[model samples]
Target: MPHPTGPRVRLRAGTRLRTTLALVLLAATLTVGAVGVVGVVATTSTAAEAPRTWVVDAVDDTSGNRWDSVDTGTSVVTIRVGDTVEWQFDRATQGHDLVSLAPSQPWETVWPTALQEYRDAGGPSVTYTFDQPGTYRYECSLHGPLMTGTIVVVPADSTNQPPTADPVVEPLTGPAPLVVHATANASDPDGDEVVVAWELGTGGAPTYTDHTMVEYTTPGTYVVRLRVSDSRGGLHVEEFPVTVTGTGGPGTDPPTDGALPAIDALAAPAQGTAPLAVAFSTQVTTRGEVHPYSVGLDDYPSIAGEAVLVRSRGRTHTTLSVTGTKPSARHGSVHVHEQACDDELGGAHFRLDTTQPFAEPNEIWPLFTSDASGASGLVEVTKAVRAGPQAVSVVVHDPDNAARRIGCADLAPGTADLTYSWAFGDGTTATGADPDHTYATPGTYTATVTVAHASGEHAGHATVSDAVTVVVGAAATSTPSPTPVPVVDGTPPRISRVGPVRTVRTSRPVVTARVRDAASVVSKKAIVIRVDGRRATKVRWDRARGIVRWRPAKALAPGRHVVRLVATDAAGNRAARRWRFVVRLR
Candidate 1:
C-alpha cells in the first residue's frame, strides 16, 4: 500500500518531464544539422551553377531588335552545375547571321538557308563552352560590330533540372513557291547529337516529317512547328508563322512574223543605166534597226552594152557608185543579171536593156555588134585588082552581122577579059552582066562591083571600087628615008613614039610627033601621026625580027582610047606613020 501511492505518482510525473526534455533536445539538434547541410550545399552549388553564358545579339520582326545595347548586357538563364552554352544569331535577311567572338566556342552560323544560298551569302561565326561561372560576349555574325549580349545562370536546388528551352523558330520570308531550309544547332551538356523534326502548316494546312528542308508548292500563310530533341531525350518545340509570296524570273526573245515582218532594204537602186554613174540604195519597212544583208545587180544584159562588177560595202548601208561603161546592152531577150544579196547565190535577178545606138558600118569599116553570130570579126582591106587569068571575090554583109566574101568572078586577058567582071560585092552573088568588052583605047578605069547576100539586094550589099589605069602608047615612030632630005653625013636624034604616046581619057584620037637631031633633024623631022594628040616615039629597024614595035611607058584612063606612031631616023631622015590600037584598062 505505501509503494502504490508513491510509485505511481512519482513515476508518472517524472516520466512525463524527462520524455518532454529529451524530445525538445532531439528536435533542436536535427534542425541545426539540416541548416548546416543546406548552407554548405547552397554555397557550393551557387558557385557551381553560375552558367558560362555567351550573349548573342538577337533581332525581332519589327524594324530590327538587338539582345543588348551595351558592351555587357543581361539575359536570365538557368543551367546545370556544369553546362556549356554558345549564343549566336538566329534570324537574318540580306546577309545577316550569328557568331560568338570568344575563342574555343561551340556554335556558329551564316544566314542558314540552302547550302548553295548560304555559300553565296558568306558569313562565318564563333562559339564557347561554360566550365566555370562567367558572362560571355556574342553577336550577330553580320552585324557583330553593332550587337552585344550576356547570359546569367543560378544555383541548383532540390528541383535542380533546367527547363527545356523551346526550339528557335525562324520563319524564312521570301518569294514563293516557298522553299525553306534550316540547320539545327541544338546541343546537350551530355555530349549527344541533336535530332530535329518539323510539323509544317498547322490548322490542317500541311505537315512535314523529320526532314531539314520543307517546300510549300502552293501559295498560303502557314504556321510551322519545329520539334527539336537532344541526346538526353530533352525535347523543345517552336511555332513559326510564314507567308508565301509568288512571282518569278525575267523574259526574252523577239517577235514573230505576224508582227509585221521586217522588210529588209535593198542594196542597190532599182533603175540604173549602163555607161552611167549609178548609185545603189535601198530601204526596209521596219525602223532603222540594222540587220545583216547582201546586195547584187542582175548583169545579164546591160542597157548600155557594158560589163559590170558588184562590190561589197563594209556597212549595212553603203553608197555604191559604179561606172557601166564596159558592159553590153540588152540586145536580145531580157538578160537577167544578179548583183548582190544577203547570200552568195540565188539573189534577185534584174534586167537592164542597155539599148545603145547601132553601129554604122561606113564610119567603122567592120561594124562589130558584139552580138554577132560569127566566131571572129570580118576582115577588111582597100580593094583587090588582077591582071591576066584571075578569080575575084567581093565582100559584103553576111547573116552573122559581119563583112565577108560574097561574090566570085573569073576572067581571061582575051576579048572575054577586056571589061573586068564584077564579082558582085557579096558572097553567093554575081551581077553586072555587062562584062568582057575591049576598050577602044588603053587606059585605067575604076571597075565597081556591088555584091549582095541572101538577106536582100541592097540590105547586105557591098561596094568595091578599084583604080584602073591602062597602058596605051603609040607604036614606035618609024622614021622613013626622010624623003632623002639631003643632010650632013651625021646621024640625027629621032623621036620615039613622041615620048611614049601620052594618051587622054577619051575616044580614039589623032597624034603628032617631033624629033631632035644632031645635024638639024628638027627641020628635016616630019610630023608623025598624032596619037592621042601627042608626039609619038620614033622607032628604028630591028635586026632580029626585021621589024620595029612601039611600046608606051605609062597608062591612061580607059575609055575609047587610041595611040599613033611617028619617028625621025638618023642622017636627018624623017618618016611619019600612024597605027591604031585599042588599050583596055580592066
Candidate 2:
C-alpha cells in the first residue's frame, strides 16, 4: 500500500536491518516539534531570508511509493534553521501520510495540510520550514517503522561551521606488530575547542586524543580514522591507511628505497657419504635496514640460539650443523627415509620414503630453512644406494604463507659423492660410477679406472687389467660381429682458429672460434664466451658446424679486453681458452 503522505521511506535492500537500528537510535536522541498544522507565513527581516529548497522524491514501485534523495539515501538530512524541505509525492501513489513520531505528537498525527490537499487534487506537494536547531524524527503513519527519516537542523549563523579534520600517519608500512603514529590537524571557524577521537576501521573502542600511537599485531592493511568535533556540535572526520608487511619480526625495520631482505651467499659441501657430518654457512643481506633472522631444518627443531638481530646494511653469516646416518639395509637392499616440515618446530611434514609399501627403496635427503630466502643441508649415500639411480631434493616452504613448495634442488645420478673414470689405453675413455667399454681392434690394451671422491683433495686410480690381449680369427659364415658396446666419451672439446688478438674500432667486434669433439658438441650452450670475466651477451653457437660466435651488445669501451672461451662436449668434458686484446677508439 502507498503511504498517505506520499511514499514510505525505504532503506537500501541489503542494509535494512542496520538502517532500522540506526533510525531507532536517532529517534531516541531527537527532539519532537509541535504537531499542529499551522498556516505558512512569510517573516520580514532586515535582510531578505532567501529560502533554499531541498527535494524529497516520492518514487513508486510494486511495494509502494518510497521517499528518495541524497539525504534520504542515508535516512537523514542536514539543513540550516529556516530552510524549506519539499515532499514531492508521486501522483499515481496513495495512502501514505507523513506523520511526526517525535515526543510532542502521537504516531498518527498527519503533518502539513498540503499533503491532504494533494490526496484530493492529485497535484499538491507539501513544504515544511524548520525554525529551530534540533533533530526531528518523522515517519509515514501507514507504513509505520519501514518509512522513517530524521532531519538535523543547525543554526543559520555562519559562526557555527564544523571543524575541518586532517589526519597524518607516519611510517605507513613495516613488518608485523607494526607501530603507527597518528595525529590530526583540526580547526573550527568559530575558534571553538575541538575534541579528537581515533578509531581503527577494523573495529575497537575508539581512543580519544588529538595525537596517539597504535600498534598492529597482525600483518594487513588497516584504516586509522580521526573524528574531530567542535564545542558547537559540528563534526568532521578523516582516515589514513597503513600497510603492515609479514616478512620479518616486529622489531624489524621498515623497508627503505623499497628493497626486500635477501640471502646473499650459501656454501656447503655438494656431496657426502654415509655417517657424514657437514657444516654449512650462508650470508643474509638487506638493501636497507635489517631485522631478526633464523635457521631451521626440515624435521629437526630450529637452532634455538641462532637468531641474529641485524640493524644495518651489513651481512650476517649463519652456520648450521647437519648429520646423516648410514642407510639401514633391508631385504638385501638399503633404504633411507627423510622428511621436511612447514615450520622450524611444528606444522605439516613432507615425507620421502621409497620403501613405503610396494615401492623400491630410494635415497632421500631432508630439506632445511633459513628465514624466507634459502636453505642448505647434506644427505648420506651408501654403496648400496649408489649402485642404482636415485632421486634427491631439498625443499623449503614458501614464506608468503602459501602452503606449497618454495624452493627445490633435484640431485641426479653421477652427481653423487663419488665418480669413476676409465681409460682403455685405446685412445678411448669412459666416465660414470660404473661404466663398461669394448675395444674395436684386437690388441693388448691397458685398462685403468680413476675414482674421484667428493673430498676435492682425494682421488685414486686402479688398474683393472694392465695388458688384455685379444686375437681376431676368421669369422664363421653365419656368425655376426659382436654387438657394439657403448662407452662414455671422456675427451674434452678442442678449440681452434681464435683471433682478432688486437683491434681498434668504434663498433662492437665479433669473437669467433671453431670447437670440435670426437663424439659431438653438447648443445648451443656448450660454448660460453666471457669478456672481462663476465659472460658476454648475444652468444651464438652452431652445434652441427662446431662454430662459436660472440659479440658485445654495446660498443667496446677503449681498453684492454680479456676474452675467454670455454667449450664442453656431450660427455661432460670441458676445455677453456683465453686471449687479451686491446681496443682503441678511431
Candidate 3:
C-alpha cells in the first residue's frame, strides 16, 4: 500500500489539526466504552424502534447541517454494504456529493475519487462496500462550510451493538399544529430493524403502515401524536399540541365583510376616431373603504377617473368611471383592477373588457354601447318583432367578470328591459322584439339603425351602417323543343369533328362536331360516345343552346381517331353518328 513517508508534510495548524482529528476519528471504533452507552434498555412496545425515512435533503448542503438530515448537524444512520445512501435535494441550494478520503486506504479512496461523476447526477446516493473496514469523510462541493458528514464503516464483527434510541418529544401548543412532516429518530440497541408508525389513540388502535405525513386544509385545533417501534414490536410515543390560523375559507354568503365598488357602462363615440367609455360598476361593504381601480387596453393604461363612496341605508357602494382613447387593435380583452377592500386587508380583484368588430349570421349586425342587466356588454343584432324590411336590435349588459353579479350594478337587476332596433338596407321593412333583419333584394347594401331607450335620453343612430349581402337562389331556364325531321330511309348518322377544340385543358375544353341524325332527327336524353371502342366519361350538356361536350376518359394519342355518337330523346327515336378526325394532344 502507498504510504506518506516524506518530510513531515506540514499543513496549516487549523487544516492539519482538523485533518488529524478526522483521520483518527475515522480509524476509531464506535464500539468503544461510553458513559451514555450504559443502562440503555430495549423495549418491544410496538412503537419504540420503527424505521423512519427522511428524503435525503440536499438543503443540508448549505444549511450548515450535516447529511441534510434535519435542521441539526448529527445524523444517525445504519446500513449494510451495497446499501444506498439517499440524498434528497429538497430545497437544498447547494449541489453536493459524497467522497471517502483517507490516507493509505485505496478502496476507501476508490469511491470518493469517482464521487465527482456521481455528484453531477444527484440521487438518494450511491452504494458502497465494507470490504475494507475504515471510516469515510465527505463534504458538499457547492457549499463546503455548510455541508459535511461522516460514516463509520464497521465490520460484521463489532462487539458493541447499536445503542438504544431515546424517545425525543417536541412539544407544541394546540390543535396539533399542522404536521407537515414527521419522522422517527429511534434506533435499535442490538442493531435490530426499526419500523415507525402512528398510534392514533389508546386501547391499541390499528396503526398506520405507510408513514405518510398528514395535513389540515382548514384552520383548527386537535390532539396529534407520533409512535415508533422496533423489529420486536418495542414502541415509544409522544404527543404534541399545535394551532393553525390564517386566511379564512372562500366566501359562502355574499361576503358580509369585504366588498369592492362598481362602475357604469359607456360606449365609444360615433366619430371614427374617439375614445371608448369605461363601463364598470362599484360597491362597498363598509364605509371609509376606498377601492382603487384602473382600466387599460392592449397593455396601455387608462385613467380610472375618481372613486366616490356613497352610503345606502346601512351599507356602502362606490362608483368608478374610466375611458379608453385610441383605436385598439380589433378584438382584445380590456383589463380592470379592484385596488383595495375595506374590511379585508388583502383586497380582491377582477377584469372588464369587450370584443371588436363583432359579427352575426344573416342580419344587420349592430354596434353596441351600453350596460344592461343580463346582457352585460355583449351586443348582438337579433330578429325583429314585426317583419317588413329586416330589423335588428343591439343589447348590451355589464361585463360580468368571474361570473359574479351580486349587488355590483343593477343593469336590469330584476329584468333587463332595455332594447334598441335598426333597419337593414332594401325597401322591405319589419319590426319585432328581437335584433335581426332580412334583405329584400340580392345585392350588397349599407343598412343602418337608430336605437332609442325607454329610460334616460339613451338615443343614438349608428350611421356607420352594417353591410348586407343578399344571395339569390338558383333558377332553371326554359328550353325550346326541337322540331323532329320526317324519316325517309333508316340510315345511321355520321358525326365528324369541325373547328379546332378550345384546348385539351379540363377547365376549358371545347370540341365541335357535325351530326347528321339518320332515320329521324331526335331531341335526346342519353348520348354514348366511344373513342377506339371505349365509352367517354363526364359528359356535359346545354339543352337550350343545343350544345353538348364529351370529356375523354383519357387523353388520346396525337393522331387520327374514329368516334361514334348515339342519342335517344324523350320520343321513341334513336340516332347514331359516326365520324373520324385528327386528334390533338397538349
Candidate 4:
C-alpha cells in the first residue's frame, strides 16, 4: 500500500485519478480524454508552431515545507502566453489549492480563478494555460503566502499586443449599503478580439463581460480589479478603490480634503486643517513571529520608508504625505496615530470622529507602493494634528493580515521629549534601546515598546504602547492541542548514503538509503520513489535493513534513468534526494 503523502497513487499504466468534488471549473473545463490532458492556447499565427508544455511541481506538505526558499522546492518560471503548465501535487498531504491574488492590488485578495484544486479525492496533476500575457502570482490556499509561486507570461507574437483596461468605478464613496458600478473600456493595439473579466474582491464569483454591477454591504475599503486580454495573448490589469461608510460607529467623519481612497481603494483617508512641516523616518522590520506561525515574515524585512505630516492640537483632520524609498513591489497599509512608535506602533487610528466605526471615513490611512528605485511617491491624509505628543507616528501593516505590522516611522517631535521602555517576551525588561535580548528557547514571542512623554510640555498624560510579534523558530505550542508537532519535535529526520548510482548490470536494481530521526521515525513506509518526475508504485521498503528497493513491473529500458526519493519522519519533516543510474546491454 502507498502512503497518503506519495505522489497521486498510480493505478494502471494508462489511467489517471480524478475527483469531481475537488476540480475547479472557473478557469477551464476538465474532460480527461483518451490521449492525455489539454487546456492552453496562444495568440494569432498560421505558423505559430506547436504549443509547448511546461511542468511545475507543487511543494508537497510532507516535504521540506513552505518555509524552504526556491532552489529548495518553490518554483518561479517565465513562459509565453497560451503555453500549458502542469502542476503535480501527488504527495500533497495537506491537500493544497492554487489561487491568484489580483497581483497588482495591495490590500485586497480575490479567490483565485484556478483550473483544478487538489482535495483528498482530487487528481494528482492539474494544468493551466496562460491565454493572456501578464505576471501572475499564486499561492496554495492551505499553506499561506510563503508557499507561493509566480508565472510571467509574455506575448507569443510581438506584432499582436495585449489590451489595456480603463476601469471606471462610479460613486467611489458613500454610506452603508453602497451600490457601485465598475466598467472596463479596454483596447488592443492590434485590433484583436478581447476578453474582459472583473474581480469584485468580495470572495464571490467574477463577472465575465466588460462591465458588471456590484453591491458593497460591508463598511471597510474594497479593491475591485479588472483584467483585459487580447486574442493574441496580450494582457493588462487595472485596479480601483471603493469606500463604503458604516451606518454608525465611535467617531465623526473628517473633512473631505482627502476623502478618496488611495490609488486602489487600499488605505488612504485624509482629514485635517493646516500643515505642520514635520518629518521622520524608520526602517520596515517584519514582526511576524506569532504563535500560529504567520507567513511572509522574512519577505519584506528590508522594506523601509517615512512620512511628513501636518500636526496640531484640537483639530479634526490630519494630512500625511509619505516620501521615501520602499524597494518592494508588494504593499501594506499605512496609518497615522497620536503616539510615536509605541506598542500598536503609532497608537490606534487617529480618528477625529468619535462616532464613526474604525474605517477610512474617520481615520487617516495613506497607501503607497514603490518602483524599481524604491520611490513611494507622496501620500496625504488630512486630520488635525495635536502637535507634540499626539498624531506623531506612521505605521505600515500587512496588506492581507493587518495584525502584522511590517514597517513604522516617527514624526519630528515638537517640544515633547519622550523616553522608552522595552519588555522582551521571555520575562525580561529593559530601559532605553536595549538590543541585547538573546534568544535561547525556541518559541513565539511578541515584544512590546512603551513611550513616555511626561515631565515636559505633556506631563504624564502622554503614555502609549505598541507591539509587533517577532516569531523565532517554528510555531511553539504554548496552549494544549491535539497534535503537538512544533512543541514536541523541532528537528527533521536525517538521510544519508543513498544508493542506485552510476551503472547497474542487472535489470532489477536495488535502491537503498539510511533515514533516521532523533525521535522515532513514525512513517511506516516513509520512502516514496519517482522516476523522471512520474510517481512509481510497486516499490518495496525493507525497514529491517533501512533500504527501499525498486524493480520494473516488466523489463528495464537500456539507457539513463533518474530516481527521486522523498522520506517523511514521524514529525512530518521531509527530505528528498535525486540520483541517476544506467542499464546497459548484456
Per-candidate TM equals 0.16, 0.23, 0.18, 0.25
Regions of candidate 4 where Cα sits further than 4 Å from its true position: 1-134, 137-157, 164-167, 187-191, 247-586
lDDT of 1 by residue, 312-379 (tens): 12121111111111223211111111211111111111111111111111111212222222111111
* Sliding window of 10 residues with minimal summed lDDT for model 3: 15-24
Tens digits of per-residue lDDT for model 2, 1-586: 1111111234323232111100011111111123334455453212134546556654444433345553445444555555666665653243345555433321112232322211211334556775545555565432223345555455555345566655666776677788888777767667889777777644577778778888887554455655566766665544344656662111112212222222111112212232222222221221110111222234222211111111111221111212121112111111111111112211111112211211222222222333221212212222221211112222332232112222322211111234445565668766642344544443444445444444323333311221112222232448677886987788888776564476533234556676766455567767788888898766777664355766555556778888899887778899999987776542
Give the number of the best model, judged by TM-score.
4
Which is the better candidate, 1 or 2, if ranked by lDDT? 2
Looking at model 3, residue 14 earns an lDDT score of 14
Ranking by lDDT: 4, 2, 3, 1
Between candidates 2 and 3, name the one with more favorable TM-score: 2
lDDT of 4 at 150: 50
lDDT of each: 0.27, 0.41, 0.30, 0.47
Which parts of model 2 are misplaced by more than 4 Å?
A: 1-37, 45-49, 62-66, 70-75, 91-94, 103-123, 163-229, 233-586
Clashes of each: 78, 7, 72, 41
lDDT of 3 by residue, 1-586 (tens): 1211111112222111101100111122111011122122231212222322222354432112334333222332332222223445444432334434343222222233333312322333333333323345455422222244444333333333332323332222223234444344556566677555553222144345434345544332223344444543233333332333332211111222222222111111111111211111111111121112222222223211112222211122222222222222221111111222212211111111001111121112222232221111222222321111101111111132211111121111111112323344456433322233433233443334322333333223211112222223223227764675864554544343332222221111223344433234445346676666887766554342233455443335666666676766544456676666554322
lDDT of 1 at 147: 31
